[model samples]
Target: MTRDHPADFEEIARRFSHLWQALNEGSPGTRKILVDRVRDALDRGEARLRDADCDIVANSFVLEALINDGAATRVYRARHRDLGTFHAIKMPRPDHADDPVLRKLMLREAEIGMGLRHSHIAATQTVLRLSDGRPALVTEWIGSRLAELLQQRPLSLGEITSVMTSVLSGLEAIHAAGFVHCDLSPLNLLADGDLSRLKIADFGIALKRGSRHSQFDLAFAGQPDFASPEQLAGEPLDERSDLYAAGLLLSLLLSRCHEESDGTKTLKALTNHLSQQDVQDRPENARAALHLLGGSPKRPVDA
Candidate 1:
C-alpha cells in the first residue's frame, strides 16, 4: 500500500491552526474565551517551530502494521513515504492524547533521541502528529529486546562483554551530549541477533543534565525490578544512577552464567553500590562494569 507522506511543518502548523479554530466554534461564552486562549498558545507553538527551522525530514511516517502495546503507548511498524522503507512509531493511548504533561514528556524523549547519534543507541527518526491529533515518535525499528534473547539462551561472559561494551559506549556518547537516561533496564534495551549487537531504546524518562525539569522527583522510571536504590529512595541523580543500573545488569548476567550458581556477591555489589549513597560507590560507569567483567581488579567475589 502507498503511504501518505507527512506534511511540512509550515503546512502542519496551518492545519493545526485551522483545527484549533474549528474546536473553538459553537462553545459557551466562557468556554469560547478559554478556547481562544488555547488558540493563542497554538500560535506561539507555530512561532517556535518557525524559529527552530523545523525539518520536514523529522516528520513521522504512519505505520501500516501494529507492532506491540505497552502501558502508555502502542508500537507500530510503519513505512515512511517520505524517507521510504519501514520505521517504528510510538503513540500514546487515544484517551491520553490531550494530556499536557505526558505529551511534553513524550516530545522531550523524541527530541533527546533525535539528538543522539551512537552505534548502540536506537535512532529517533521523527516526532509527528497522528491523524487523530495525537503526538507520536518515529524511530529505527529494532527486531527484539535484549531480555528476550537472554531469556532464551544465557549469554557467555565473552558475549555479555560485547553487549556491555557497546551499551557503555552508547551511554558515554549520551553523557557527552549532556543527557541522562533516567530509565535503563532490559526492557528498554533492544538487540538484533545477539546480545553483543544491542541498542539502547526508550527515553521516556530521560532528562537534560541541567534543565530545571530534569530535577523532578521520578521515584522510579521503567521496570521496578531493575530500578536503582536512589531511584527507589526518590533521590536526585546523575550519571552514577545509570552506573548503578549497569551494575544490576551485570548481576543479571552473572546469575545466568551458571544454572546452579547463585549470584550472591553480584547482588551484594549491587546493594553496596547503592547503599553507600554515593554514585562513586557504584562503578564509575558502564566502562567500569565492563572492566569488572574483564576481571580488572581481581576481587575474590563470586563470579
Candidate 2:
C-alpha cells in the first residue's frame, strides 16, 4: 500500500520478492507497483558493481601530483593504494605516448631499473600498464635532487666524502652488473629528504658495457656538463666513462661548499684528469676513483 526508499539494493530485492509473492493476493494496481520496484532494485545493484570496479584508476599506481616534466618523460607522484605508500611513476610525455620509439625506451628503462636493487640506487618498485597499454616505471619516491641543492649551497669535505662514497657504491654495483650509466649527472642524482643518502635515477639511455649501440649513442641522452670525453666523441663506452662523469661530479661536490679547502690540489687534479679529452687517461673505473680519493697515488689507465 506504500512505497519508500529501501535499506539497500539487497534489502530492496528481498522485500520486493515478498511483495511479488503478495501480488498474487492483491489487485492488479498493486502488482504493477511491485514490478516497477523490482526493476529499480536491479538497476541499483548493477550501478554499485560498476562503481567498485572504477576504484582502480591505474593497474598499480594512483597519481597524486605531477612532480616533474622532463624532456622525454613526465614523472608523477603516486601511491600504491594496495600498499598505501608513495612512489614516483615515470610515463612518456603526452605527445610522445603514441610514439613507438618512446614506448620502447620506456620499456628498456623499466627493464634496467627493475634489475637494480641497491641502496644508493633508487629501487624500481614495479612496471605499471596504463589504460592505453603504455608502460610506466614506478620507483620509490624521493624529495630532493642533488643538483638543485648544490646550486644553493655547498657541502663540507666530510659531507662530500659521504655523498661521493654513496654515489660510487651505486656505480660499482651498476658496473659490476655489466651496465654503464651513460647519463650520470647531478641533475639525475637524488638525495633522500635528509640529504643523508643518494639514489641514481633515469636509466632510459643506459647501455650495457661493451654492448652494441647507435652511432650517435654518445650524444643521444646525456647531460653535457657530466658527459665524459669518450661519451661525447661517440667512442665505445665502459665503466671508465661513467667514472669520468663521477669524477666531474666529485669535483663539483668539493667546490667551496666545504668550510675549508686547506689543501685540495690533488682532488682538483683528479677531477680535471677524469674529464680529459682522452678516455684512456681517466681513472680505470669507479674503484680507481675511490682509491684516488683515499690518498692513493693516481695511476690512471695510462698503461
Candidate 3:
C-alpha cells in the first residue's frame, strides 16, 4: 500500500513502539532513546500553516503554491513529506513578526483554534515556527471562499439552508468554547465545492469573554455590512455578535434564493431580529437562531 507521510512517520512510529515496549519490558536505556527522539521531533517545529508566492520548507512541510498574500502575512499550500498530505500554512511577514501586538494576535488566534472542535469549524492542526523563525499555523486546506462561491452560481433554497445551518453550527461550537468570533464575515467563511460543506474560519480577531484584550492594543472595527451594532460601539462581545453575522449571511443568501418569494418575509424578519441595535432584542446565541430556523443545535458548554 502507498503511504502518505514522509520517512520519519515510520521512524517516529518505531520510537513510540519501542517506548511502549520499554514500559512493559523494563528497559530504561531503550526508553530513554525513544523519549529523546520524540522530544527532538517536537522541538523541531515541523507543522505550521499556508501559501503566498514562494516555495520553502518550514519544518517537515514544504510550502508551495502562493495562495494568499496580505500586508501582514502570507499563505501557502504545503506538503507534509512524512504523511504525504497537503495543508495550508499561515505565517506573518518577517518584518511584522517583530511587532509585539501583531505577534500576540497571531499566537492568540492559534491558541483559540487549538481549543475548539466542531465539524462545521475548520481544524487547526498545529502551530510551529517557520524557517525564518516566525510562528505559523497549519490547517487543513479549505477549498473555496463562500463569497467567491456565491458569485459563481445561484444556490437553491435547500442549498442555502445547508450552508447557513452549518455556519451556525460552527458559531455554536465557538460559543460553547467560551470565545467570541469577533470578526465574523462572509469573507472569513469558507466552503468546499457545491456549497454542501461550509466551515466558519478565521478566528484571528476573536476575543475571550471577560478577558481584556486591549493589553495588546488591538481592536476590531466590525465589517460594515455584517457587523452587529454593539460591535461597532467597541463593546465587549459574547456569542450574540457571531449570531448576528450568521443571520446576515443567511439573509444575503436567501435574498438571492428568491428575491420576492413567499418565504422572504420570515427570513427577513429573522435577519432583522439578529441585527437589532440593542443586543438584547436579538437572538442571544446560535442556539436561538437554530430554534428560530428549526435545526438541531449543539448543547452549550459551561465556563
Candidate 4:
C-alpha cells in the first residue's frame, strides 16, 4: 500500500501519538511534558499562519509602503498596476480579516462612501476581495492625516476657518445622505499641503439617521473624546450627534492655535454650543452648524 504525507505530517503524527500515549499510560511528568510540546507546536503553526496573512497583496495594485497601522485596519500607499496611479488601500488587520463584525463594518463604509460624492469627502474607488476572502477598500490618496499635520504646528485663523469650513461642508453631505459619521476625529480627516484641500475619511462606524442604538453597539463606535453625550449613553443618533463631533473637532483645532484673540473667543462659544451635554442644545444639523459658522451652503461636488 502507498500513502501520501504532507511536509509536516511526520512531525505532527509523532507529537499526536506521543500525547495520546501519555494521556493513556504515561507518568504525570511525562504527560505534562507532552502537553507542553503539543501547545508549543500549535503556537508555531498559528505563528506561521499569521505571518502568511500579514503579507497580503492584490493582483491589481502594488503596495508601496505602509501608511497607517490602525486598530482594526492597515492602510498602504499603493499604485495600480495598469493605471499607474496611487491610491490608499485599506485592509483589515490580519487578526481582524476573518472577523464578521469587522468585515461588515468595512462593507458598510464602502456602501455609504460610494454614494457620497463631494470634494471634501475622500472618495471610495472600489472594494477588492483578496484570494483569502478579505475585503480591501480602495480610496483616493490624500497627502496627510489631520492629526499628523496638527502635531507639526498650530493653524492660523484663516487656516482654522478653511479646515472647519471644509469639514462642515463634508458633514452636510454625509448628513444629507442620511448617515451619521459616527467616528469623526482628527485622525479621520485627510488634508493636502497648503491647506487648500481637506477631506473627511473613514466611515467605518457610521450610523443611519434615527437608527436605534440596539441596531449596533455604541461601545466601539465613536471616539470617546469626540462622541456626543447621547452617543456615549447608547441613545438613538441623528445629525446632531455628528454636529457635536464637528464641534469637538473645531475645539481641538482651536486649542492648537494661539489663544485669547477675539475670533478665538467667538469660536470657543460656538464650540460650547455645539458640544453641549444635551443633544437638543446643539445645532440641529450640519447645515445649521455651517450657518452658525457664517458660511453659505454650497452644493455638493461630484467626486
- Summarize candidate 1's per-residue lDDT along 1-303 as a digit string, tens digits: 223445566677898787667676745775666665775576557656674322222233445767787767778877764457777888887768787767877898898999998888999977878656778788898878877877887655456556666677778787778777867778788877756668898888876763333354343465666665666666665667777677677667666665322234443454355334466666666555555545422222222
TM-score result, candidate 1: 0.67
- Kindly list the per-residue Cα lDDT of model 3 for residues 1-303, writing each as its tens digit: 347667768877997786687766866777667665675565454333324423455436777587788788888888886577988888887768777777788888899998888888888888988655688889888868888867876766566667767877888888888988876776787876645467877778788764434545755554768876767667777888777777778778876664444445656677788777677888878887877766323222111
Compared with the true structure, model 4 gives a TM-score of 0.77
Q: Provide C-alpha RMSD values for all models, in order.
A: 14.7, 10.8, 10.6, 14.2
TM-score of each: 0.67, 0.75, 0.75, 0.77
lDDT of each: 0.67, 0.74, 0.73, 0.81
lDDT of 2 by residue, 1-303 (tens): 235545566687997677867788878888778765665566556557783322233644567888888876788888775578888888877667688877887888888888888888988878878666767788898878888878776565666666777788889889988899988888788986444478888888888897534732333567778887667766678998888888788778767464444335666766787777677888788877777767723222110
After TM-score superposition, what is the CA distance of residue 106 in candidate 3 from its true location, in Å? 1.1
Worst 10 residues of 1 by lDDT: 51-60
- Candidate 3 ranges beyond 4 A from true positions: 1-54, 211-215, 259-261, 295-303
Q: lDDT for model 2, on a 0 to 1 scale?
A: 0.74
Model 4, residue 241: distance off in Å is 0.8
- lDDT score of model 4? 0.81
- Flag the better candidate by TM-score, 1 or 4: 4
Residue 177 Cα positional deviation in candidate 3, in Å, after optimal superposition = 0.9
Residue pairs whose backbone atoms clash in candidate 4: none
